[model samples]
Target: MTPRSIDEITARADEFADMFEGYDPKPGDLDAPVPPVMAVKLAAWRRDVAERELADAVRAAREQRLSWREVGNAIGTSGEAARQRYGATA
Candidate 1:
């Protein structure tokens, strides 16, 4: 599959959410007609897009000389924790 943009992934996720709305009363839903392979493809696409976006954000944050405190706050972690996790890599 081709690389997908964040917007495309978000849009497809939204579509999947819509598809499951008020699904059914049965326990299995296994008889449902959705393509099982589509779920796998979407999950892989999401992981790729998320990683790219995270790398870009880390690069931008480092370029701005923003503190690990700020980044960690945004990520719900301690500054030291954030640095240990991503600083050198960033």
Candidate 2:
């Protein structure tokens, strides 16, 4: 998937968050069909949450003076690639 801008991610993520936040369940909802659009939005929100979590983990590792190579190894990527993707100037 192409990378989304932070603004877009934040906006869309919040929309999904609100959707589930005030959700009121109805009887037979489990057996009812869900709108495909909502399903897609849920999937996107999940991805956004996981990515933010990964970013936080990476930031912690960097703060501890961990090498990009080590981070890459742990995350199944190359050292330089990891650094570039995470916006690590060093």
TM-score of each: 0.50, 0.60
lDDT of 1: 0.83
Q: For residues 1-90, write the lDDT of model 2, one tens digit per residue.
A: 999999999999999999999999899988887699998999999999998888889998998999999989988999888899885533
Candidate 1: list runs displaced more than 4 Å. 1-34
lDDT of 1 by residue, 36-65 (tens): 799789889999998778767866897899
Candidate 2 — which residues are off by over 4 angstroms? Answer: 1-33, 88-90
When summed lDDT is taken over every stretch of 10 residues in candidate 1, the lowest stretch is 22-31
TM-score of 2: 0.60
- Return the lDDT, model 2, position 60: 89
